[model samples]
Target: MEAAIAVLVAQFKAFAGADGSTDTLSKGEFQNLVTSQLPNLVKNSADPAVIEQLMSSLDQNDDGELTFLEFWQLVGRLANQHGGFSR
Candidate 1:
């Protein structure tokens, strides 16, 4: 579980920027990150053209980058869909 969390965090950081802090991302930056890193999930996203289209729906802030809560919500949803961690 810890390892999975770390991998998720690292992936988020990669998208979020070298600063790797959620606070550092602009809406555009966050969208780019999702497009590149979350291709599997976001490729089929309802609005595939702009990353912000999907992110804005999920983010709810219209501010762009996801807050930690938003990020965790995404991960949790995905994990539930995918059956979460395995032994």
Candidate 2:
């Protein structure tokens, strides 16, 4: 469990805010992370429209970026669905 959390955090930091901020994920970063890291969970992740729509839905504050909380929530949902963690 601890390892999982660490890995997530590391990956988040690795992909967050290419312009320098380590606290949030820009749309491009989010798209890259999803398509590259979560290929099985996110089908057609390379599709810009799909990523944009998904990002729009996840951007709760409509800030055009995702904080770790938002990104974590999306991962949790996808994990439940794709990784069968819900079961």
Highest TM-score scorer:
2
Give candidate 2's TM-score: 0.91
Cα deviation in Å at residue 64, candidate 1? 2.8
Tens digits of per-residue lDDT for model 2 on 1-87?
999999999999999957699899999999999999999888899999999999998999999999999898887898788766687
Prediction 1 TM-score vs. true: 0.61
Number of clashing pairs, model 1? 0
lDDT of each structure? 0.63, 0.91
lDDT of 1 by residue, 47-86 (tens): 5455556566578665656775677766676557667453
Best model number under lDDT: 2
Backbone collision count in every prediction? 0, 0
CA lDDT of 47 in candidate 1? Answer: 52
Clashing pairs in 2: none
TM of each candidate vs. truth: 0.61, 0.91
CA error at residue 25 for candidate 1, angstroms: 3.3
